[model samples]
Target: MNNTTHLPVNPYLPAPLALPLSLVPGKTYSQVMARLLNKLFGPELADGELDFLEGKIMRVDVVDAKLHFSITLSQGVLAAADTKCPHDLSIEGSIYDFLLLATRREDADTLFFNRRLRLGGDTELGLYVKNFLDALELDDRIGPFLQMMNGATTLIGRIPRLAIPKLPFPKLGRRS
Candidate 1:
């Protein structure tokens, strides 16, 4: 008997791209995320604005994409955690929701309130991270690329979310 299942169509990665994406090494995920995050939050790192993350593990779970990335801050530098170790905090959500949050299309509070994003682990750490995300500002110095990406994300959000069959999505290893 066929065991294929269906899930909402993803406007972000699509079924084809999702497969290969999942095969990427965990180290690569860490490297890419660390580089991008460091670039985006360099000032905060230098100014010690993110010192609270020192020796802390923050895991981001992109459910639809079947990807998990763990990051840590040490000596004011952001790097990827090299193992499948436990996390001090975890932020789980779909790619679309993450895009919305990052693009300022939706605030972190609203997403958590609406249950689109789930926050787990140390409450104190979670609250601090949540506040940080909510307070993120897209200034001109950060440039207009995010604005353009936001437009694209908004358009992608409009795509019908009806279930797509035979998507080959892996079983979600939800945390208890």
Candidate 2:
């Protein structure tokens, strides 16, 4: 069974919008995710620690979003790979599953073993990716931001509903 079969589309992004989301160019995904990846592993990337990933195409599939992108590192930079090239590794899951993994709300073993996240293609590549993620300096990089977000969410949750007011708007239409 597909992990995404019974999983709901992310609340923040509707399923019907998958088509539009998939329409985003591969170049855009490559650039954005590459920059984010570089930032997240700045020291390692700069030290040639990720040179092993060079020329290895890895495909990420956001299942519910119906979006996929293939990328490879080249000259120490991530770049969109030619779609015709076979991916060395493939990972698929719903958006929320990915979020859970990223936020450490759920461990990778749990998600992968539960079938909430799927991996295919080369087993070695999978191991490499998992090891890389494991070695991330998360606390050193994004700890402060996560703390701020957590504080903000806590404060926002305590706000009373009445603190927000809804206003009505009049609609204009053709008139005789």
Candidate 3:
């Protein structure tokens, strides 16, 4: 559990998008996730072990002109990984819907039972990751990463808050 107070400039990749200054938001899964885990848990990985896993886990296979992600989780660490990429969970729905579901962990199992999360591959892996991810509170870890991806500020200056738009609520006004 090594924590990094400052984000080092890793020359191997472009610095992730900054935060707090007004920037567009969209990121490839790998770029956003890699920088995130590096900053939050850089101490957790001493070498390229995580990166190797990154290539191993965060991958999409293409066959017959179709593409799908083949994710593998190493049990227990799933929670930590999810905290870093809450938006990228492989739930059964549009990416936006999945992100919305991710922000609402209390309803995750409900969604899963409702057939809203189309899971594939190892069930045990899914359960392990889901439980671990379910238990985590990752606002602190995710905030900087989101900010960095949004391109406003960086690890420097004040850490920006993770600003996910509030989900729209059902209309309850009296029927006309």
After superposition on all CA atoms, how large is the RMSD of candidate 2? 9.0
* CA shift of 42, model 1, Å: 1.3
Candidate 1 off by > 4 Å: 1-13, 164-176
Assess candidate 1 and give its TM-score to the true structure: 0.80
lDDT of each: 0.81, 0.73, 0.40
- Compared with the true structure, the alpha-carbon lDDT of candidate 1 equals 0.81
**Residue range 119-167, candidate 2, lDDT tens digits:** 9999888888887876666766798876765554344334333334677
The residue-by-residue lDDT of candidate 3 on 127-173, one tens digit each, is 65567457556667677655444342222213333457999999899
Top model number, lDDT: 1
Q: Better model by TM-score, 2 or 3?
A: 2
Rank order (by TM-score, best first):
1, 2, 3
**lDDT, candidate 1, 51-99, per-residue tens:** 8999999998887777888899988899999648899999988888898
Model 3 has an lDDT value of 0.40
Q: State residue 73's C-alpha deviation in candidate 1, in Å.
A: 0.4
In terms of lDDT, model 2 sits at 0.73
Select the stronger candidate by TM-score from 1 and 2: 1
Report RMSD (Å) for each prediction in the order shown: 10.0, 9.0, 16.2
lDDT of 1 at 148: 76
Backbone clashes, each candidate: 0, 0, 10
